[model samples]
Target: MENSLLVETISCTDGSLVGIATLNRPQALNSLDLEMTRILDKALKDWSQQPEVVAVIFRGAGEKAFCAGGDLHSLYDTMIEYKGQPASANEHANRFFAEEYELDYLIHTYPKPIICWGDGIVMGGGMGLMAGCSHRVVTETSRLAMPEINIGLFPDVGGSWLLSRSPGHTGLFLALTGALIGASDAIYCGFADHALARDQWEPLLQALQSTPWARTAEDFQKVTDLIHALPSIELQTGPLESHRALIDRICQEYDLERIGVSIAALSQNEDKWLSRAGQTYMNGCPGTARLSWELLRRARHMSLADIFRLEFGVAVECAAAGNFQEGIRAVLIDKDRQPKWEPATLEETAGDWMAPYFALSIDDPSHPLATLGR
Candidate 1:
């Protein structure tokens, strides 16, 4: 034990325990690597079975972020080592997505109340974890997004499901642009349940510890009520809220090409935020943009477990393909910020180009996460 996933228990007033999981990779913004994911999975599984454990709280170790995203540096290396192999032949990529998505799915259906201290940066995998929790607390410092477009990957970790259900077409706009949203925006988008000041974390924890738990179905509501009683910081309208009508209009069409054209035209918008979002969409990987759009549509009616299963295949495929590796090289390794995405343009990424990504990477019965929902 490296304590990368620090686990502890706080005794509640009624002698029950509140399990606390702190993601300890602050230097990396508490990014979830394979080891951390495994540790967290085991801890959560054990706690879910423990009679004395009434609830669980998940938080990151630093002031900067809860968890920025997944461990991309490691994924990049895996892609390089397994390059040219079949998607399923890249065992590390397959295992990583399988385990990570399983952990996320566990959180979604956990028996006890789960509170996410989403105080800072929450993106990608972090967003997945937070979305699954029964209660998610955002701070004034919180900034969130699914910036996977920047990395040549579509948002995985159950993001498609969450995005599919967001108000209007805001999710589609976010998927393409990778735009960052703050606390107010997070609550507005239903990604977060409550907002509190960053400094209120200590008070909230102390309140939780002193509470007399009922140890029944009402415990979830009890936790919610306590969080609601806490003081929240005043928030102004976020860019997403301000530009809602425009985003809805732009992404209303079901056709990806029409949506792309509408979003690309925002590059000249007077608001700097909208303009930058448009530029990001214009600069993002064409394949990723297409996947984001299509996945959201498909996930609209799919179960959470099914979405996880679908994302597992897509993630592995991206690793086997060159775009994800190229993205990691440019963004993280080489620091060049110029990924040479295959099929390079939005026009070239349309039609059945993404059909292969949607197919099963691993056979049904033998699939790593085949037992997910069952």
Candidate 2:
């Protein structure tokens, strides 16, 4: 199908079928904007109802990235157009996040087996897309992260749901540090299913198309066997395994204050990875770190729809508070590596300060995402 936001093609081989969706914007690392989100959502919905499409595969056009993130520059420009008035831009941001969240939810509940070939940089919104697929294929070149903290935002796009469920304290560690995970590490953290060499992708695609589509499970197995037929490639070990002891020890503290103390302890540790993670956390937005800690903890028992709703609340509040603009200024616009975060120290960030962000006024059940229901 012809799409302005992406390229879509359906290729058939033998009795099997394949549906390919490629993010077409290589210049922006396939960053998703409102139009892109709409296009993706429409395509996925259509593919779900197509009888000929036995399996779907997602990828990016360039070698550089699967998707770097949402189109924050567009968001920044919109914010500017609204003159930074929170209420003026509130509806626009609300609609965007609602649509994006819906797209993520659709991916999570897709009927057919969806295989995402996350080959390169997959952060923020990209992670949301890939994490929900049935078969998440990563390559040695894959770099996955939920680095929303760097932009003074807590990880959204169902990050609270997925990251909270990661092994041990690994989720919290990644959320706070914005640390990048290679393919093997992604698999270890439950974010990716398999790690195949980048060169093996075409062969795997061919193998997928060669099988009979009538019996999906059997055909899936055939494709798996074909992929396994290739010689096994050595995977770079993840840092998680090596730093497990320290990560568990430091990340065990659920509250932000204790977590800061634990991070301080890591700064003094012998492990280099832990020390680096500590510094990253130290340099990150204290408010966001606290919010991340709270969001994950609270989202544990919440339904997916509820999670999105809660995130919508937080997102609007963040816009109102001016952190989003500052974050965009420092990270994207200024090209400056430094962000002068408010409440610069973790010690200054109190539980009560974050409480207001989480508070949804009972009278205002009018969230743009209020229509979202399980």
Candidate 3:
């Protein structure tokens, strides 16, 4: 139980090896649990320090999902206890977010290249893992999303930084609507680099291993060039490319009220996918949508380290506020598919109450993540 038999290493014929960390919970769709996060943090740290670890290949242990998301059921249970205790922010979600974000930041700044073979349902925490990797690969079957809005949580795990950097206002649409996208959509949004078919997984791994590697900056280039040289068919064109103009226009409206009105009207369009995305925004937790919007706005200039720090504070608060618990209950637990979100509508969701989540909660040098990116 302690070890994820799922997470292991792949040694190359050459002196170097690839650290292949698999999300092992296939039955749970390899959803990231606390144990998986902790194991990954330690494993990745070790891999990062090892000179022979040429790169790391991350994937999920399933035919279905790369990773569905976090272990929301566990998160919900812990959050309920946090509510019962009604204690300081430290007791709420600092442990999970701190470790998770630390791991994410490590991937972002890792000296060695990381290849995230992102396929199937890569959402929420899965997105965190894939976002920072040096080489992100997806297949036609890849169904990618943030989907935090559905569970009354904003996109954390450096979602702010990644989303903000995405082209145009597509990021805003995704954050609000939690729409699922495909290979090209991920590329268009800057979340992934390569799109290959499912059959190419083994061949790609072979390509990565057979390449003569050296421990130098040019070695990184070698890894990238090798990936490109692999036989890969073009991906199906994603919808984002066609909707770019309208998405940009809608996202350009900075005011939340105006954006809301515009998105609502856009839902009436003949395109069902775009219409569904709009409808999701209308039905999702208002608090989450509001928080996501503000986070993206402030995320533009944030350093990666700072973004993690900021996300920790905001995520911790969301835990204590009870919406995350209730939301997860509706979606993952009770499965009633109806969350009784407090301040049920955007107009009623208090900006004043949400304001605290945006503020810095920890700045001491001894903070767990203080040394991140150093």
| Candidate 2 weakest lDDT stretch, 10 residues | 1-10
Cα-based TM-score, every candidate: 0.98, 0.91, 0.95
Model 3 error, position 208 (Å): 2.1
Clashing pairs in 2: none
Top-lDDT structure, candidate number: 1
Better of 2 and 3 by lDDT: 3
Q: What is the C-alpha lDDT profile of model 1 across 1-374, one tens digit per residue? A: 36788999998877899999999999989999899999999999999889889999999997899999999998888888888888988778888888999999999999999999998899988998899999999999899999989889998999999999999999999999999999999999999989999898888888888888888878899999999889988889999999999899989997888998888888989999999999999889999999999899989888888888888888899998888898889888999998899989888888788988978843378777888879
- The regions of model 3 sitting more than 4 angstroms off are 1-5, 84-92, 362-367
Model 3 weakest 10-residue run by lDDT: 84-93
In angstroms, the error of model 1 at 175 is 0.5
Write the residue-wise lDDT of candidate 3 on 1-374 in tens digits: 63542556777778788888888888988888778888888888898788888888898887898888877776777776667554244352677778888888888888888899998889999999999998999888899999988889899989999999988898888998898899888988898998888888898888877877886667778877987887775876688878989888988986887888888786788998889888888778888988899889888977889788878778877887877888898888889988988768787664586776765544657666788776
Clashes of 2: 0
